[model samples]
Target: MKKNTYLLPILRTAYESLTKSEKRIADCISADVTTFIGMGIAEIADRTDSSEITVNRFCKKLGFAGLQALKLALASVPSEEVISEEGFAKEDSYQHIAEKIFQNIQNGLADTLSLLDYDAVEEAVEALLAARRIVVFGVGNSATICQDFETRFLRFGSIVEAYSDVHQQATVASLLSAEDVVVAISHSGATREVLDTTAIGKAAGATVISITSRMGSPLAKLSDIVLIGMGREVRYRSEATASRLVHMAIIDILYTGIALRRKDYAANIAKMRTVIRVRKQ
Candidate 1:
């Protein structure tokens, strides 16, 4: 796979989960990427006061093949293009706040794209397309996303449903068959209700696809395909709020991908438009 251009964003996104020694290495690189790129694995290990094996493991965690690949990828990044993750301050004017919000969303989307695995997305589209039924589950803020997914695909002539209530989700999951697909959306990927419903769906032999921020979360573990996105937190704003856009962006991707592959896409959309036109008249 081609390397992503946004190296620092990837590092920033993964920084919280790194081990102490791994963090030391990450700090050294993020602090001075230009100088760090010139150094070898042994040199990086020595600089970080860690071992070569630790360095290799750190590289793997960042999706690099090894130190050389990491260096090459980092070197490929244009020095002038840096991501600014700063949030708006309380004293900022309304205009400034709007600009900051736009920039944050822009950077967040790029960061998510950097972490995205296209192969996994393609797999998800295929699963959704072939499924006998598609059941979507989410709760709280995510429930809105589930509803959005349901509405988008429903227009494309797909047998899809979205459930926000835990009981309804469970009931839908219980009746799923091998040919069904379950899509679970959670920002933290630890939503208990979502997890339980997804588990039920999996138990009944349905394929599970999860869109979440954390790769190691239980929701990801339960999924047949995991699509991870990033959302940075700013003061006064929750990460979940930021991640909603990211999750919806992924949904857009899936919606477009599936729509493209469906033979009746144009016809289905045209029929829906015709029906809506009658109400407008």
Candidate 2:
């Protein structure tokens, strides 16, 4: 009941030990426990073509008393929180819409923290730290993501160059070399501009780091290393807000890592004085 945190890992272990039919139910439950949690033993059994008794045994194997305890654990399972525009749209008011969107933003931030892969992030830090120059490439809506990464990297004393324009990004890619590091970002991993630009960097022998979604995507395949940005996606959503959050989360991790490593990067950044000085004079 209170062992849901330990449940998945144990299930994964049991799954490794399971017989063929038992593994079927484990696979179904593991795929999306949220849905499985809401479903009944009979319903799930019917769906998976397994028996209720088999499902109960699978549950007991994972240290649950029975299926009911497993269901309760699933019910208590903390799902990723996201704001739904469609749900808010039904409310039909501007204020309500605003509130829901903000909630989604908050939830997106939370979800980002929940799914962040620290090991991959540490590798990214080492990449940025080890690179002679860092070139960030993104296009269209993702171009803004590139700029954000550039800003954060620049603050850490890395020579970061970012391009949102396709032509300029292409030109920047041409200057890339093995001594350089390139981070290409695309939520779908299908942006032609980003893919093409990253290809140029890769061809020039720069270490390629792809921040993308699908594991088997082209960009993912091309990367020397990747930081997978996974999130709970909602239907008909803009993707902009969630994708930006994904980009920012990685940048934030890199920023914090670099700042910690250099120790003085933050202080140096804080010393910048604005040009508005002589007002009293």
Question: In terms of TM-score, which candidate is strongest?
Answer: 1
Which residue pairs in candidate 2 collide?
83-104
lDDT of 2 at 12: 32
Lowest lDDT 10-residue stretch of candidate 2: 1-10
User: Residue by residue across 1-281, what tens digits does model 2's lDDT show?
Assistant: 12534344334323434666678887777678888878888998898888988888877766678888877766664554212434534545898767656665565555445444567778888888889999888876777888888866776666899888878878888888888999998876767778888898899889998886544466867788876554334454656565577667777777888888987775767643222244435
RMSD vs true structure, all candidates: 2.4, 7.8
lDDT of each: 0.87, 0.70
Q: Which regions of candidate 2 deviate over 4 angstroms?
A: 1-91, 230-239, 274-281
Q: Report the C-alpha lDDT of model 1 over 49-131, residue by residue, as the tens digit.
A: 99999999988988889998898888877787565657667699999988777777776787788788899999999999999
Q: Which candidate is the best by lDDT?
A: 1
